[model samples]
Target chain A: MILEGKKRLWAEYQKEIPDDNYFYVRSCIRQNFFPASEPTFLRILRDELKKDIFETPFHTTCSGIGYHSDIVPMETTMTVVARQFALMTEAGYENYAASCITSFGLYSEIIETWKHFPEVLAKVRKHLKQATGREFEIPQSLVHASDIVFKLRNEIAAKAKFKLVNKHTGKPLKVVEHIGCHYSKMFPSKGVGGAEYPYVLVGMIEVWGGEVVDYPERRHCCGYGFRHYLVKANRGYSVANTKKKFDSMEPYKPDMIITNCPGCPYFLDRWQYVIAEMEGKTYGGDGQGIPALTYEEVAGLVLGYNPWDLGLQVHQIAVEPLLDKIGIGYDPEAKYKGPNGEDLGKPEMPMSIRCC
Target chain B: MGKLYDMLVEDVRFQEGMKSCMNCGTCTAICPAAEFYRYDPRQVIDTVQTKDEEAIEDLLKSETIWYCGECMSCVTRCPRKNAVGLVIVALRSLSQKLGYFVESEKGRQQLALKRTIGAWILEHGYCVYPRKITVENHPEAGTIWKWEQDNLDLIHKRLGSNLDGEGNGGLRRIPQESLDELQRIFDVTGGSDFYNQIEEASKKKAEEMGLSLDEYVKFVYTTNNGLHGRDEE
Candidate 1:
């Protein structure tokens, strides 16, 4: 049966890409780190693709991080997820789209748990009904936003004003795609192309005209283990895990890194800054860290969105080097300006603190 | 008395994770946490297999269970299909259920986590609402967040968000009824009990240390925030 499941994971069980309408739930980490990415995704869907996406504040955190960290109990996690499903049921949507891979995995796990243990599902239903007088019909399809992006890769590429090729070199940019751990590792059968060699992000990179750099640590976790990154003493483990990826990917000298997972982009970007500080070595050409972007942000860039408006300027390591390579225009002085385009003035920095 | 070790062995996660153990070190070989810390998934499973009460208690009380990233790297590589990651989850759960979590540095941060992420779920529906992430505490959130804090309405408007307003597509303010419903679910599911357990234990620890409850919580939050295992010279 395990062999059969593994075979189906490779052949038959990958989630079919949804079309048209979706009920979107945001991720906690993604919104905080890459707030613009979600809004950008909505804009691309609504304006560019004409898809109907309903986002509500009533949909709460999936509590995947807390649950996995052992801070929140499994029962509590499932109950909270039931509340989210209840919200979606109340809103009259059957297709659920998650903005975070962890949430995606959590939802998938809960649904799978319900399939195997109906008693657990019954208890959740009883608790949810007692609490909110609400009940949910399981969503017809549950997908990560990256899955939607993967499904629409060619359409996005067709709409692109800029390709993933370097304007100076006239060559396709060497991009390393990092899939979040939960995206496939937790539920191997659920991911597009299964856990190993998942094509969800690769589909986007290839369709957008970028070379996907295959590395030794291509399947490694970003080490954003909610508690691993949260507790201060354990961050060395987080940094060490990232350092492993950098060491493996550094020799390839990839121009940019792209991620579908909300946590991966932040850690992959921020840890490079940390890695440079700790090891006195940088990953890419020159002493600068390689540019890392979420797949949604990458799509927004290709579709001719302004970098500042997409909040690309706020990244810890500068993205201008990649912007220059992509031939995307942005006035560096106006990077941190207010919405009305007022200059915030150059930020005061300590002797060694540099941000681009 | 039913031994705590037996209860751990009977946990659903432990049952689901462990099929048969061959004492293979494949899980440890692939673990990110094992490289940096004293964590070894193989050792954790092997220790549990011994079924010694004191050994299990020590496992619960020690920082080893807290070290697994829960990445499931062990799950993918285990030849015997034993999910060492799930074993860690069960041990951590047993530790928390028995209140042994308060013994370790990482374990004590449960209160901070409950207060922040746990509280956020009930209040805002989202674990992280943009307005709550301050530049002072999270400097890595960077200048863009600082700018967003100042010009939220304008930026959100441009980006097509309602900025927590009602009847808008982007992060609409959750209705009060929904928030109440969520609270009730938490109440029913023992979330409140879990939180109270952390508070009750921490309060006792605080009283022993001669600090007020509020003062102790603040101390733990800030102290644990910076306690990422760096040596203080």
Candidate 2:
């Protein structure tokens, strides 16, 4: 479990929780917009990289970012967390995991605080008891998507069929990985590796036969000045900070930057367009954002997974170069037939992880 | 104007944070490591508003307390002024003071970030090593080897110094004496001796735990990007 940040979690927690077995938590972001990612991982688990796992639907959005963003009230959030805990308890799934980094951090805070601060926990728990009429233990088990990937590296390699034939200017694909803070920061102990750097994403990139570009700013947050993305940093600061990220990686001449978390991908992927707009320079596809991908998307591609079926067509930024390199054709609408002449549309979002 | 004391969330200037926290759990939910690590700064803040000592004390020891990336999303949207971000740092201070933080392998990286790497920016006016001037005919600064050879002028001439009061006022741009004063206070409050113990413990723990120092080290060097500015500026 040396996914980078896991050591800190282990050293800090003294093995409060660890191991490859995890209760996979889904992200609402991925579920709603990037739905393919959920099935991408689930499919890998059941079909390609078989491992021990079960799904429970007793969880809700940690709502951490939204709360901190000042959109919801503390009491409302407490009720939601408590209600989710009740669901986890009722479903008999104590371990929790989320695809989104922010959610993971939020849940960790609630659990530890409640377990230690009897008064506060008691109050929130009491409120939940009164509101939801269910006793919730709060989840003791939790993990991130990268944690699962890091633990199952060999299996991913074994199943990967598509090779990256496309590269940056015809160079061996060099990848700079930006590990998100929210993912590893909260659990410190049970974290995939440790805060700052988690190796799971790096390991997956390495297994995919790409060089891992090391940069000092690899662990820096995307300068998520949420409210100020328009006011403070606006597009200018966003572009500048993004350039800082790119400058750190440019020395390595990485073909692309890769990430696993949905928010990270959203920022890195979309911000390229913002940066291009600021710099008045055209990205590869003329207004398209720079090159990047989530590990699930990459896994689908390198494993010879279908492009359209995995929803590559909906991306705001183009990854055509990657698709071409992997010997997968670029389908702008994903309406093209496969080599067998079978038309593939898109994968439907999973409502639940039923063991069919 | 509370005298920020103890690691419990209660001791913090809750008024500063309490004004904004709708307690949406967004800070917790958006947190990257929470789900896997069992850490939620939002909960810590909730406890802080109530000033739960035991819970704060136990939390100070948890790996979660030290893992904050300091992104400050918690502050930007906190309608109630609940800076769980501030509460987390307070937890770290309390964790350090109470001797709850031991030197695990990752703690060493944090130490390097704070003392070795961060100390430079604090003491000097920049993060990189100081540059040497190569004034022609004055062999002293002549032929400066690897002194940002390309941007030697950029390094020495244009880069503003706090000495000239034209600096960006970054942590690095501050005067050494000024930083030392802050460090002295940190020594008194944040506890330097405790920091050293945890720094020591981290090395031994890394060895005892058979941790891979290289890959993890790569992660450490790549990340330590000016943590001081995580909340402000």
Candidate 3:
């Protein structure tokens, strides 16, 4: 009966695909770190998958980072979310998809708050109307971009040119999926499989023929604790939190780490470099650190997108090793090419490599 | 009897974060911040549960309130379903609102945060824009960022982002209408008041220290309490 209940929950995890139209709100961190991921997602949706996605600069940041950092108050954050919804209402898109997991979670929280307290929603509506002279209707469906990919994973896998398997060993690549803390920790019902076992990224990994590696500390925060990361005095907490996860997951020997959150991919990937430089220790199978990529980037790779075009070069830990393991061919020489196909050349000195 | 404890307990955050505290150490045991700092969520909860006005006021002015990473790990682990994270949030709100935030080392960093992140939203529409992340402050961004800055237009164009351009896709320039609307929202929702509060408190602290507000903010941004140190370069 427990197994049957689990099967029923898994079946309910999938949501209706919002292919008619989606208003995509870009993430602040995703754009800053992996600048190409959003563009790649647009390509996959518009060109490859043929889905209509509306992206705009008019939709501002969700103010989540600042709110969580304690500078922006809850009222301010909710008001900002209301404004974003107004923009969506103006554009007539009912399905709201956010590129950042933080924003996604914030949106979910704001909506839940409104559901529980109609007065709060009415007040925000009043504030938004007073501020912008614009009103909004709540979106019919709200989801993170990863949720959209998870919904369409079967389609993505069916069209994929490559599988997530080791070329020599002919074995499925062991992939570790890290769900961002905000994704489900706060509101389990809003997530794919709820907080304890979020299947957002794992769904994608499974469909792509990769084995999911379950390690301890899998549910830990990405250490993007808003203030912990921002305040210089508190960054040790951030590093230590991430180090704990690496220590737990290193024993699993995963080929690559996949994440649903924008900050998670950046922090998980960047901290490997910081950890190695500070501790003289590396985590992956070959003594190199495990490469981390967002689910969107990983999906793009499985669909045979070029690495450089997907902004893989910007990563602190190189994705080249993962690519080599999967037998994806690309010229390493032309990694950092300009818009006109002119070579920008790689960094003369690599920041951190395996040095023990 | 609107004492500090009374004021705090009346807050919705405090109400939501606290239940019958069974004096369990589960919160601290699961806290990532507690592992690294002198912070103890259990103790924080215990302190508030005492309902001592003096202790509550001291908490508002101390480093302990600022130590929570707000990951909500404590919220998940507490058998009583207490969210010490939310209580810390309430404490912080009170700290900033009452100007008690200027009394501690970590508390003073609120000014730095307000200037960079809080102000950025009102001005640029994005929290951590590329242009705002200076090469000096964020060397961890590595050389690619520097190169990206140098060739901003070309790189963004390659990535298919309109960037500063006015229009449909990519990080196009935020239209003035949208920016104006954002400012109005901040003004209406007390966000502007919060910013003013941080500025006013920091300004008073700066005056007390015989330094300008600008100098004071720079000091807060650059210095730490000789613990949990970061790259000095």
Candidate 4:
């Protein structure tokens, strides 16, 4: 997040990198939709971690992109996406990671679909054999980025360097973690330590020394439409969905909010502003936006990372007050202002929980 | 306005929708989709009545689209007896028809579902079914693929839909006959093409995604996408 968005996390500082083989597979949606986080994560990985990870531009967005939209036709999505992953494994990178939880789930589905439908397997295999002239194999392991964050929280805390002070409010933030649905819904057993009580992002917040608040609907979504809400005419539903989290989080009054999946951040942060307007709150963000956060951005900020470095400045709802409260201060002078000299509001990029 | 307008419109047999909702928020409270999707079925009902298209558009950009598990938990629980689950499908249908379906990462996830579901329907003549007797039971079949099959009979038995010759005019159905009837219904309902395309595209998707179609197809329970596969980079 410090660099941009969920490209790669904890890679920038990693010195002893895995050399054998790793999957560079990412969701096209993440790369293109949520590029800001991607650059930051990649920086941490390549510049800091010193690991060898690669990408194939040919990789298409996991049809997971359209899975919720009820378009793209499921048959095409499964076969093509499965073949793509098989190509990666065959090329020697068996392990895969996705910035988007749904992408990870979709990847999991591809495998499950194969086992359930020999026709799908046969078709994918036949096509691959004919086109690539090589056989494909589904790797034994694939996981979400948050899964690793929680797994390596202890190690990450030990390497911490900077301490964050709020830029304006001057408060030390104690955050709560919000994990996306896909991460826990797809492969409950292998992905998160606790699908019932996933501790990936929440545990990492704890590792970062941030207090994790428990809200009533803490596990709820950011109200992102699998399809754009407008086209589907589900605005009120979308807004209400977004409001549930804010309404839940507002009571706790934590210094800040944190999450792993990019999509989760959109609602956690952006939706607040919208809800503020609907609920008629005066303290709504500059644009009346909501909280904007990602696990990497949250982790990077508390560990002495800057907002600009963490890409916090791009948020529609200003985090200036948030930083002040959390003890992670961005210089007040650079307070992100919107077009009217108010807060810049949130960035207008399509954010997601997937990696490109 | 899109090809999908007529594609699956005739097939959407949902009698209850959010329009009938009275804003009880009860559906929102218990909705699994609302839990993750942030979509309040109550709100969906309100928006439809208000015709708040712009706000609805904003909702489309959210992750809620993927939040609905289509569990229908809100159907009867709703005071208005509305099922926003079906409305979500309607929203998805609209999103798909408009190129706007590609707005968020969740939208992108939809691209693969058609094929996955299509192949399932083509082979088994159903999209998804009851959850029991999945791959979890057969270790050799790989746990993830074990969840693909849905046991309607088991579910019917559980739901008491089984009219065993004595109950409600003996609504019992012969296996093949029922399937043929379903096919006929689907054809009139515009579901046949929807199903056909799912299989067609799933074949290609499996290959591209490196999924083991062979293992998944033969596996007893296969619809679940493995969960918790997030990346850090």
C-alpha TM-scores of all predictions? 0.91, 0.55, 0.94, 0.56
lDDT of 4 by residue, A1-356 (tens): 36644435433322222332456554333332233455555545555555555554334345454445464344445544565576576567866656667677667656765675666578666654543444667865666665555555665676675433343444335576777766653345544543455667766766665667787877665665553331222334455676766667766665666766655665555455444444545223333333457776766665566665565644445566665555555665443332234443322322221000
Total backbone clashes of candidate 2, pairs 3 or more residues apart or in separate chains: 69
lDDT tens digits by residue: candidate 2, A1-356: 57667755456433233443456655644543344666777777767765545554333344454343322234444556665566567666766656776666667665665565567677766666654456877666676676666667667788767554344345457777876656655445545555534666777777777778778777656654332231121223334455667656655655666786666665666555445544544334333335667777777777777675665543445566556554565545433333243443333321221101
- Among incorrect, acceptable, medium and high, the docking class of model 2 is incorrect
Q: How high is each candidate's interface RMSD, in Å?
A: 2.8, 22.6, 1.7, 22.3
Ranked by TM-score from best down, the candidates are 3, 1, 4, 2
Can you write out model 2's per-residue Cα lDDT over B47-143, one digit (the tens) per residue? 6555455655556556555545456445544545466675665555545444455432223344334443334323442222233212221121112
All DockQ scores: 0.48, 0.02, 0.60, 0.04
Clashes of each: 6, 69, 0, 199
Q: Each candidate: what lDDT?
A: 0.79, 0.51, 0.82, 0.50
Flag regions of model 1 displaced more than 4 Å.
Answer: A1-14, A278-280, A348-356, B139-161, B169-171, B218-233
Best by TM-score: 3
Give the winner by lDDT: 3
Task: Indicate the residue-level lDDT of B170 in model 1.
Answer: 56
True contacts kept of 2: 0.01
Better DockQ candidate (1, 3)? 3
